[model samples]
Target: MSGALQPPSRSGVRIAGDLYQWLVAWHGCVTVLRDQTLRPANPIVAIGVEADGAGNLDDVIFYRAQPPNSYEQVKYAVDSATPVNEDYLLSPSPTGGPSILAKIAAAWRSLTASGSQVDLALVTNRHPDPGDPLIRDRDSRTQLLLPKAGVHGPRSDRGKARQRWAVGAGVSEQELLELLGVLRFDLGRDPQHLRELVQLLMLAAGLRYEDHAIDAGADWVARMVRDGYKTLSLDLIEKAVQDLDLKQGPARAVLSIATLKPDPVADQADWSLDWTDRFDGATAYSKRRPKAPATWAQLQADIEAAPMFLRGKTDIAVTGSLRQAPAFCTGAAFRMVSGADLAILQRGQVWSTSADYEAATPAIVEHSLGQGPDLAVAIAVATDPTTDILRYLRDQQLSVGSLLVLAPPAGGAKDNSIPDASTANALAVGIRDAVRETVRTAPHVHLFLAGPLGLALLLGHRWNRIRPTTVYEDVATADFYEPAFFIDA
Candidate 1:
């Protein structure tokens, strides 16, 4: 069966519209698998029919089956028919009437004789809901029936309704074969054509730049390049146009850009030659090649005015002679600079805030601090640490006396566990143990845990002997708070 299908106009309607067009274009191809006499041993007749339970075909069920029966005995002998065809006993039904069981039997026999299996598959955007009957007859005939009246109503959403529809369908073996044959024939043509149809629908719906278009362009370009078009030239352009039959404007531009070539003259001019004088006994000239070499100053004076000594301008000097010390030399020089010297140099350096060096100073200071043992042992985390926060701490240039910060993971929920009474007690014990270990190894060492509840817990305990300080959460964001430790002040 064939009919004109209309394109969808609504938003999100591209998929449906493209599917409809594909069914229409390949309507005749539904019989591809139906050719039994062929070597491949495919099916005979294929039909795609869709019903929405409202007595209307809402979709197409593509299938493959055998040819129509010719004799009455053949039809009657077919035992696996969904329903026994009684057309042999009775007169043929009116035109366009329901097919009798005998006809179905004949189709089955034809399929079996052809040595072809019934292949059936469904292609639907919406999935059938659970508990749907999805019924099929013994002969592989299928019909999707919607739920009876009042079974689904206004309360049901689109998803639920689709599920209900799927549950009501009944499919038979013969019908399934028919459905799949139709689908295989249609789908086997070319995936790109189906994609193009979908893209056209998307373009009509104002959904330009959809994945299909982007992918199609990329794939097409890749294929063209792989097909031996090394560079885009007039010959290549003409060949592409003749081979692909592409139109002159946009298509031509695409091919041209895909095979574009670099300028040969510009590439040749990128390198230059250099000239240098070699000293030796005899007068001679030697040429040496150099890449991107510099030009030498011209000898403006006349040749007659030039005086020739013992050594020739182009002679190669011996290695030992070249290593000899010069007749005249300069004095040896040395200078020492320290942190104070660097500070003086920094004072003299015209530091502009907009310059990159000015921005790098804090990083240099942090590097200096990080080199120390105390700061290296400090573990830190930020709730939502930012570059500015890190930069501020680094600017302090302090060798921190053991600090720890905690922050949430990226893109995670910010619901960090606040230390309760039990948690606080456990943390206090752990901190005490860590402090004792540090004291045994190196006395006067300070430990700090900075967080909202950590600070509160430490303050409540008044752990003066432990040398532990609790810093508030906002202290992390405060630029005025330096990283250095304070003693009792």
Candidate 2:
């Protein structure tokens, strides 16, 4: 939706709505093909044929054997526009002859005559029509009782047209009635469905649009269709980049054909996505990185693999220099693991919080504000006194037990300094045993973490494994803390 489109003049803006409407219908059919249950039944082999774009039908869904698959026409009308109704079934178009109803009949007839079975669907973005023949389907009825007049028993010119359509399709009135059973009318009023479409398109496009621009995904699809693409492809996004016309900038640029140099270290990562908290705080740190392939196929795969909700029990890592670690964790920590990246990380260790660990924790500490019936233990793992945070929790009246594990007395200098991985492992073991000793007396644990990043990661990794825990980081402002973003079990 953020990508460029043809210049937006007054006319283009007006036409955009209509184009988007058609795209919605078209994408609707494409979605059906993606559904495992519906696709196995409908089995769309080809779609959006040349005849469809020429206005013969909005789309022709093909099947393995023949004609009785499906023909769909998607229509949209704004508040001021005319609503779609059964009248279109018999009415004549501006070019004369039969209207939408006649055309659908003709397509059905043609496909049936060719030894195919087909059904007609009129998908509309308008309000549900009470008078619609298919309204009974809304009542959860499995079958539609065919009416005698407009569809099957018309005696006038409209009836004559159906007769002609029947003859052209080589099907009798009874066969037509049987086909009518498959006729569908999908009224579009559910905002949830529209949201799903927007999400699906985001997966297909591999780009995040502003919330207001979700509907614009359809417009992008329509552009791909209008550009003479017969089938949807992941490459259309790249073409969109080339076709973009930025009216508010330099209109022309000098062009020189040149060969691009290959990267010395090719990036193997294929996709990217992020999750945020209600406060507009990102789970991961804000940092720039090399781009990955921005293709729809990869995006779709990524969306399918995304966790439905961030789970509880996770880990976070912070650099030692990030003195205000909790605040950084609040807005800057992130975890993004792609199919390729996951493979690499499993084979080795990678130490960047922004890219590898954004999805590992809850985005904010407020997620635990009222998350208690059980008593909580606030454990501060640091060298110095954590009285500020402890006092703040007490002042806030969060009923919880508290413990402070000060640096060991008469310990080695490394005990006070940042510990290495092995030392962090030993420290993590000690912390886990202490927590195990405490949780037996309490029900839950809320952590106030200090000390080195290695220690934090090691402790978090182990604690999260033991049980789901709430981990907090210290922010810059006095007496404030933010939750670490590691909530998975």
| Best-performing candidate as measured by TM-score | 2
Q: What's the TM-score of every candidate structure?
A: 0.19, 0.39
Model 1, which residues run further than 4 Å from truth?
1-16, 19-113, 134-489
Query: Model 1 TM-score?
Result: 0.19
The most accurate candidate by lDDT is: 2
Deviation of model 2 at 253, angstroms: 42
Worst 10 residues of 2 by lDDT: 250-259
Model 2 agreement with the true structure over 203-273: per-residue lDDT tens digits: 22223323334445455556656777555432443343244421111111111110121111111111123
Whole-model lDDT per candidate = 0.25, 0.40
Q: Write the per-residue lDDT of candidate 1 for residues 1-489, one digit (tens) a residue.
A: 268765445543554444433333232121221132121233423333222221212133233344321111111111222222122212344684433322333433444456654332222222222333222111111212212212344355533433333222223433433432322111122343334333322221122324433344334334444564322233432343345433221100000000011111111111111112222122112121111322111211111111122111211000001100000000000001100000000111211111121110000012233422342112122133333444544675444443332222222213243223333334333443444444343333322333332222222232334333322122223462322222220
